[model samples]
Target: MEDILKHNFAAPNQLATIYYMKERVEDGRSYYTFEYGLRTPIYATTSFATLQVMADSLKILQI
Candidate 1:
């Protein structure tokens, strides 16, 4: 998991995934692992104005 985060993350966009597995022993055991990543084209917006613009453009495109 850390391996994937170290190898795949860049600077911007982020991603994560988790998994759980069970194993049988004298008692049952469960383990969990996770990975995360960052890439490009990610945006940090303070308002919905840009989203509204995108929605309007998509509506125009549909016509």
Candidate 2:
């Protein structure tokens, strides 16, 4: 799996196929490499409210 450095409060789902999608305010959203050199956006969320907002926003895109 491609090492993904996410916020301390972030969380990832059980499936190895999913993970915390790394993003930024400057370059907008971006993709991170995971297992098998797969590049996919994070689809998980942590209990942290701040992080939750970012994760929730992803739903709008149906990602």
- Clashing pairs for predicted structure model 1, backbone only: none
Give lDDT tens digits, candidate 2, residues 1-63. Answer: 122223222234333233344433534544332221122374433321112224435322222
Off by over 4 Å in 1: 1-27, 38-40, 43-63
Off by over 4 Å in 2: 1-16, 26-59
Tens digits of lDDT, candidate 1, 1-63: 344333433332434332332222333322232222233455422211110123224211110
Best by lDDT: 2
lDDT of each: 0.28, 0.30
Error of 2 at 25 (Å): 1.1
Per-candidate count of clashing residue pairs (backbone under 3 Å): 0, 1
Cα deviation of 31, candidate 2, in Å? 11
